[model samples]
Target: MAETELVCANRECRIAQGGRCIEGHDDLAKCLYYGNEPEEGDQNEADDDQEVIAPFNGVYLPDAHPLDSRRADRVLASLPSRMIGVIGVHDSGKTSVIAGLFDLFQMGPVANIIFAGSSTLHGLEIICHDARAASERDEPHSERTKRGEVRFYHFDVLRDGLLQSLLIADRSGEEYEEVADLAANATTMFELRRADVITVLVDGRRLASSRDRADVMGAIPLIIQGMAENGAFSRKPNLAIVLTKDDAVQASTRKDQVQRDFLAIIDGIRDAFASHFGEIGSFVTSASPKDANVVRGAGLAEMLEFWMKPGAEAQGIRQHSYSGRVFDSLMIEEAKRG
Candidate 1:
């Protein structure tokens, strides 16, 4: 390299070497230091002004994802966690319920429980996107869980100052329904065997139609029966028969009759599976509602509280109300306000 003195004061200018301003100025007169002498500064000061880049010491990690079946056990081994398994037929709003709870935490404390933290923020955000105005969709919807792509979302919450870890499993409803055909189908769904709370969703929209009501009401028992035959319940976990899409049912003409049918179905499930479950409960929830009359995330408080604390004698459908916790609860007042 030939040693050449700079023609301008600006250290960045390469006019002497390239016959043009390195700063890309169109006119020579326009250059700030075009006709000025370069400053004689301390070598240290020149070194300090130069950009210094550090070496690439660390590798980039991928975005956080929901826990897989293999990883679920590892998390459970490290932390004292509770596993929640949500089961339903296709389009039963199973995924929406999980997404709604995550949405509630974004506001503040739900049912008064603090929004502590989540392991799968990306997964939750993906499910929640379509329901928000940012998605640019006219009607809100939940992204359906793909078959065989089961994942478990984790939430670490403070319950009365005690950090309670929760692992909520998500999978396609079609997969769960497969267990009804053969008990062996549940072998792939090992989460069910270890679940502390098993929530079976009843689609309120299906219940609204007389044609679909009977079949919809009958589906839950078959799921339970097959799982039971598979020895899915080694220990009796608390059972929550959640009536999802309450807003849809609210907007229907058969609202009253649907509610009646829901109760009857609950009673039947209780009597049939009472021996297999620790505490049998029924809850009504509308995660994201189309009807203005029905509140978003309605009745999730009771459902969550019930899941947290077992041995509740839940005989009927839980109303959309939040009762404070003497023990741990979801203090859902803030979430319900929306």
Candidate 2:
């Protein structure tokens, strides 16, 4: 038969130029569509034979899961836990501090606290990924943590051969601000209430600057007042007022000047919340230290020792804890010296 005169047996085939199928099969016998046309009974059979693929059943993985309160509760149910909650305003260095604490225990033993393991290794990797990358590139900026999410970084530490579970809450500065502003009613507030130790991070670089000191100092009282209003201080959680970015402050000014600045901020916190709580411990910390290429958690170990174990070197004058009356009197004495 001539090419044009020839017709495909399959009704689904569109005859192109010649006797070829649209799929480029020229021979009628070789064409996939040739005898594949569905008839009345064939349609039902084909439909019945078709296998349906199920949705993925193995597992779903994320870069990191935000340790919300529910996940924290579940995690705590599995272990004997001590909760350390970090509080700060936006860019006040709460995440960096938590990452530093992780690095400290992960790298090696500190003050006889051996690095055992962690349940949320992926979560730690996500939080520290940028800072690790930045260190390699010699970049000035570290990663900013996710805002408004309260994440828990888990750690198993062996202190003097005794294993203990440590849960540190990494919350954004905005979350703290919300509570400070009396706006937060979410799970974060409850997390704060449950915290065994609450550390308030004050940006050292900002507090060191004359122009920023007033605003920074002014915000401290409001946050303390807000926490007090929300009953965070009702149980009198162990308070640590951590001055972060100490490296930046030291690089820009004299050591004595930085000490004065540190004292002022601590005094401000003391004045604001002293009567509400029994004792407060203040420390200067640098997550990214000057001599280290990576985060060494330089000042974190001391802070941890002070809160976790009572009689480490943190019991000295630098990490001293005092009652409300004693702290107020010290503040008065320091004010007279200035």
Candidate 3:
């Protein structure tokens, strides 16, 4: 103090005079900088940035639905029969949903279908084979890698007393785009084209995703439009727009935001067809395996239930759709006619 020492400007410098460092740290020469705060305008710009929307509010029903006497009697009397094709974009859980339905059907929880393998009655034993993708290169037929692998299995049933088994033909996700022509033919000219019902399982997350929505919607229009225009889905076949992965849709408090997002997507798809088809039933479901998370599994089932027969009702068999029942009845009529 007596010598009037000048402290170095560097915060860590111990030098008593000017800008020189007394600590002998060679890096002091590069420390001539001050931290500056962001300008106020930049903060304002950040406020306008887009925000990610939250998921939708999904419904979950309890197990073991109570039966409706009148409805059950009526449905059984008519006994819905038809080749119901379930389809959707890749990773849409079409196979999972079918598996779950099979589980339910075997348990006799859903409708009582005439199961094959028993020597009691006569009905079709449906085969569910996942067609693999055909290889591009010169690979042996055995070596030809399955482009798309089927996900579900085939079941046999005799439709003597109830609606027999369903032959679940699983086409791999890889084939979704490539098989549009096949799907179209399936809906239009194939034997199942005359199906009494058609269940299209759509992936909720994919449909909700802003990225994939457009392309997916684009791929489906031709098939659906062709189906409707060619009198395939026009039988007023009780159409079930089964939504897979409902848990993802409802795992948040941001349903308003998510619904708007999905609504836009669905509307876009609807617009693509341009009033070509009527409003089909909508359902959300989660068909992940036992180990799969509950949210995903339950969510998918919920979505599917919303638009389908039993799930569409008030959370039970009592609340099934008469339209769905009617659809089943029509299919049975078609089968009987055949």
Query: Evaluated with TM-score, which candidate comes out highest?
Result: 1
Residue 92 CA displacement from its true place in model 1, Å:
0.4
Candidate 1 versus truth, CA RMSD in Å, comes to 15.0
Which consecutive 10 residues in model 3 have the weakest lDDT in total? 119-128
lDDT of each: 0.82, 0.69, 0.45
In model 2, where do residues sit more than 4 Å from their true spots? 1-66, 133-135, 183-188, 290-295, 310-338
In model 3, where do residues sit more than 4 Å from their true spots? 1-80, 105-108, 111-163, 173-176, 179-192, 229-236, 251-257, 264-279, 289-338
1-338, model 2: which lDDT tens digit per residue? 66444454454455633344766665667765565544667666667778687788787764445466787787677765667777788888877787777777766777667877777888776667666655465643446666755678878777776777778887667767765556344334666777777788888888878788777777876777777776665556678889898887777765566677678878877776776554689888888654454345768888888656431111223455567675545633334322
Q: Which candidate is the best by lDDT?
A: 1
Rank by TM-score, highest first.
Answer: 1, 2, 3
Model 1 residue runs over 4 Å out of place are 1-55, 310-338
lDDT for 119 (candidate 3): 19
lDDT of 3 by residue, 1-338 (tens): 38743434334444543545545655754434212234556566666555556777888743222112332233234434233455565667765665455444444433334344321111111211121123232311111113433322334444335544333334544454444565444432332243334566656666566676566556665556645655554344445566566655566454455566555546655566534333455555665432234622343333323323321111113333455555655433223324
For model 2 the TM-score comes to: 0.69
